[model samples]
Target: MAYVDSADRGRIRLRRSSLICPGDDTKLLGKMETVAADVCIVDWEDGVVPARKEEARRLTAEALQKAWRCPERVIRTNGMDSDLFETDVFAAVAAGVDSIMLPKVENAEQIIEANLLIDRAEQAAGREAGTVEVWALAETVQSVQNADAIAEVPRVTCLIFGGGDLGADLRLKRIQLGSNRTLGIHRYEYFYAYSRMITAARAAGIDIQVTGFTSYTDLDASREDAEISAQFGATGALAISPRQLPIYNEVFGPGADDLVWADKVLAAVDAAAAEQRAVVVVDGSMVDGPFIRNARFLRSLQDLIDAHDGSVG
Candidate 1:
C-alpha cells in the first residue's frame, strides 16, 4: 500500500487550481486573493517585457508583502541563464514568497544551483531552512529528457510544462483541432515529452501541473485541455485568467460519479473486513488492491474539497 505522507495529504486537501497572474499587474494581484485558486503564480518570465523586468519584480515583491491571505504564492523567475535570474531569486526570497519557479530548466544541475541560491537567500532573510519550495518548468527537449533527475531535487514540490516555449523548441506548429497535424508529417519527437514529465513527477511523488490553453475566452477549449491533462495524470492545470479558474477547478476535481463509486467501494471493503475477507465484489466486479487505492484517493480528494472553502462545486 502506498501511504500518503503529511505533505502529500495536505496537498490533496487543497484546491487544484493554479492561477497565473502577471507580476506587474497589481490590480489582478489584489483581485486574485478573492479567487478560488489553490496556488497563485506571479509570472516574470514570459509575461514581462525586457524593459519592465525590474518593475515587475518590484511589484511582485510588494504584492507578496501586502497581500494578507494568499494561500500559496509562487514567483516564476527568469530562465536559469537569463541576466535577471539571480535578481529574481533574491527578490522572491526577500519578499517571503512560498516558492520560486525556475523556467526553461534543462537538467538536474540547474535545479541544484537554483536551490543553492534559494537556500542562501532564505538564510540571509532570517527565514527557516526549506521555507521556500522550488517549481521546475520542463520546457525544452533536454529538460524533458532529464525530467526524472530534475524532479528528484529535494527542494522541488511541483513541476509544470511550459507548452508555448516547448512547442517553439520542438518547431512543431500547433494544431487547432483535436488531430495532430505536426505528428503526421513533422518528425519532431517531443509529443511524448509531456507524458514523460508526468511520469517523472509521479515517480518522485510530486504534484504535476500542465499548461492551460491560452484562449481564455473559450471555456470549452480550456475545459477540454484541462480534461486531457487530468486524464494524463496531471493533478491540475494552470489558469491564465480568472475566467478560466472555475473550468480548471471543475475538470481537475473529483466528479459526482467518483464520489458515488468511492462510497460503494468503501462500503464493500468494510463489509468484507467484518467477514474477515481480504477481497470484496462491487458493482458485479471483484474489487481488490487497486480499487481500494483509488477509493482512498477519492476520499482524500473529498477531504481536501471539504477543508477548502474555495471548491467550485
Candidate 2:
C-alpha cells in the first residue's frame, strides 16, 4: 500500500514488511510476486556488483514495467555521485516506477539533483513530471546530521535507515548492532541517529523506515530489533531475506488487543455521531478526536489486508 503521510493522518501505509530483491537476478525477481510484502524494492545498488550495474538497471526497469503482486514497487538506485546514478534514474523514470530509492544521501542538494535528473528523464520519455517519487537513504553521519533538511526535499517520500553502513561508520561492532543488551541498555548505539531520523520524518510528515539486522538466520534476534524499532516509532523495517518477511509483518501488524480496542473506539464514535455528539465514552475511557482518528487508522489496515487477499467479504 502507498502510505499517506500527513500531520493529522500519521503513517497510513502497511509497510510492515519490505523485501529487497537483487535486480540483476531474474530468479529472485520472479519470486517477488509470491512474497507477502508491503513494498518490493528492486535493488540496483549494493546487491549488484559494479561490473553488472547496467544489467541490474535494465532488469529493474523491465521488472517495474511489468505487473507484480506487491502493492508499492520501488527501485533502489546507485548513489548520486556514482557513474551509474544517471542511467539508473533515467531508466527508472522511463519505466515509470513507483519511487526511486537514492542511497547515501548527505544533503538536500543531492536530492535536488536526483529530482532534476528524474524530471528530465520523465519529460524525455513523455511521462508525467513527478510521476516518480524519491526515497532518501540516511546512512551516513552527514546525512543524519542534515536529516531535517533532506526530509524537506519535495521529491522525498520517506527516509530509510541503512543500519549496516551507519553502524560501520560509527565504528560500532557487529554485535552492538544486533539485539544484544549490555546492563539492560538497549541499542544505544543507534539511539542518536534513530531519534534524529524519526524526529525529522515526523516533523516533515513523511514515513521513516529502518533496515539492518543482518542475521537473516536468527529470527528471534531480528524480532527483538524490530520490537525496539517499533517502540522508537519506525514506520517499518526492510527484510533482507524472504525468511525475514513473516517476522517483520507480524511485528508491525496490529495485534488482537489492538483490534479489540479499535473496534470499541470506532463503535462508540459511530454511536456518538448518530446522536449529534462529538464525544463518547467507551470502557470507562473518553472517546474523542484522537481516539476516533486512531481507531479509523487501525481499521484501515484491516481493509488493506482484506483487499490484498480478496477477502473483503
Candidate 3:
C-alpha cells in the first residue's frame, strides 16, 4: 500500500539532512546506519564507477536488508537509459527499500514507466505494487519544464533537484571569465530554476529535496545552503557526509522558538474565531488567515519531530 494519502499528504514531513551513501562502499554503508539523518540514500548512480555498478547494487540491497532502526531508506538509481536501472529497481524492491530515487527524470511518461516497472517487479516478487515510493531528480531542462507532471506521478513521493548535473547540462560555468577564484556567472538563473522546481513540487503536493553539496567537509556552507533551500520551500536536502547531517537536521527541523510562536499564533486565531472576528492580534502583531496557515504548518513540523522521538535535535 502507498505510505501516504490525501489526508497524510502534507503531513508526511522530513528533516533537512539526508545522508548519501555510495552503494558500493560497504564501509560507508555501515557508518550511515548509525547516523542521525532523516533519510539514508544509497546511491547507485554518479557515486559508483560504471565497472562496479552491479556490485554497488548488490551491496546496497544487502545494506538495506540489514539496516537497523533506519528512519528512511532510499536507493538512488541510474537514469532510466542506463543499463543499471532495472537492476537498481529490482534490488530496491527485493530489499524492501522505503523509496527509489530515479535520476535525470525528464517527464511524466518516464516516471509512469518507472512506476510500472516497480509494480511488475513487486508482483513478480509477490509483494504489494505500491510498496516502494519513487522520487525523481529534476536535473535537465526538460525535467524542469515537466516538473509538475513528474511530481504528480501516482507513486512519486518527492522530487529532488540535481544541481550539479543540472548546471553542467545548462552549460553554466563555475568561473567568472576574468577571475579564477570567484564564483560563477548566471547565479541568479540557478536560483530562479531552483525556485521554479520547488514551486512545481508544492503545487503537485509532493515533498522536495535539494541536491547534495559536493563539499562534504564544509558543514557551515552546507547548513546555510540547506536553510536557504528550506526557506524557498524545499522540504529537505541531500548530504554527502555524516558531519553534515547534524547541520541539515537542525536547519530543517522545528526549534523551540518556532513552536512557541506557533502556539501563540494558533491560540490568538482560535480566540478570534470564538469571538466571531476575522483578524487576530498576537504579541501586538496583526494576523489573519494566512498567518494561521503558517502557524499550522509550524505545528505540523513540531508534530513530525515529536513523532520521530526528537531525533532531529
Candidate 4:
C-alpha cells in the first residue's frame, strides 16, 4: 500500500476514453486535433513498424507541437528492448507530452528508469521536475503480478491494461463473429486480471484503465465492454478507434439520474450538518458519512466535465 491521500490530488484524471493514434499515420495524427477523447496517445509502440520507429517518433513530436483540443496529450514509447526506447522518452518529454505511456513495463524498476529519463529531459528543456507522468502498461502475466509494485513507483499516475497484448500472450481468442460464437459472446476472459490490477491500483490510490475490444465496427459490443470495465472500478477505457470514443464517454460519463440523486444527497447532508445532526435519510435509505462522500465524488466528476465544456468556473 502507498501513502494515504489527503486531497483530491489522487483523484483519477477525467479520461473517459484514451484514443491511440498510430505515430506513422500522419492522417490520423492530423485528425487528433479534432478528436473528442479525453486523452490522445500518439503511439510509437505496437502501432508502428520497427523500420518506421524513427519516423514515428518524429511525427509524434511534430503532432505535439500542434495545438491539441484534448485536455491530455500523451505519447506511447517503444518497449525497453527497443533501441529507440530512451530516445523516444527524451523526445516525448521534450515535446511537452502531458504523460508517457510506457509499453511492456514488467516491474517498478522500468517505471523508475522512465521517471529518471523524464527528469533528465525536463531538466535539459528547462521544464519543472515531475511535469510529466508515466502511465505504465501491464499487459503480461509478470506485469500483472507486479501491478501493486508498479503503482508504488514515483511519477506513475496510472496503470493501463494492455489487454490485446495480454490476450496474445495468453492465446485467448478475441471476439470474432460467427463460428467462435461462444468465445465471441464472452468477449473478454481477463476480468480476473482486471480485478487484480484494480485492487492493486485502489490500494496504491492510483487510477486504472482497461484496454482491448478491438472490434471498432461494433459500437454495441464496445459499449458493453466499457460498461463492464466501469462496473469493475476502472476509471477509463482505451479506444483503438475513434468510433469507440463516444461510446466510452457515454458509458463513463456520470448519468443524469446519478447527478440528480447526488445533488439531493449533498443538499440533505448540508442541511443536516447545519442543524448539528449527524445523519439523515433520503429516498428511504440512510444518508451518512459514506453517502455524503459518494455524493461529493459524483458532484466533483460532474464539475470536471462541466469545466471541460467551459460550463463551470
Assess every candidate by TM-score: 0.88, 0.89, 0.90, 0.91
Tell me the TM-score of model 3: 0.90
Model 1 — TM-score against the truth?
Answer: 0.88
Q: Candidates' lDDT values, in order?
A: 0.78, 0.80, 0.77, 0.80
What's the residue-level lDDT of 118 in candidate 2? 82
Can you write out model 2's per-residue Cα lDDT over 188-272, one digit (the tens) per residue? 7788999999999888877888984666777888888888888898878998788888888777777678889999988888888
Candidate 1 per-residue lDDT, tens place, 1-313, comes to 1222436523552437788878888898787667778788888988888988999988877777765433678899988898889888888899988888888889999888877888788888888877688888887888888999998887787888877677777776563222233343222343497679989988887888877766677677678767877888888888877888888778888888998999999999999999999879989999989889889898888777766655443
Residue 298 lDDT in candidate 4: 78
Task: Summarize candidate 3's per-residue lDDT along 17-62 as a digit string, tens digits.
Answer: 6878788999998887788788888888889999998898777777
Each model's backbone clash number: 1, 0, 0, 0
In candidate 4, what are the lDDT values of residues 127-156, reduced to their tens digit?
A: 787767778889898888898899878777
| Residue pairs clashing, model 1 | 13-304
lDDT of 1 at 157: 75
Better of 2 and 4 by TM-score: 4
Runs in model 4 lying further than 4 Å from the true structure: 1-9, 171-188, 311-313
Candidate order (lDDT)? 4, 2, 1, 3
Which one wins by lDDT: 1 or 2?
2
lDDT of 2 at 98: 79
- Local lDDT at 281 for model 4: 77
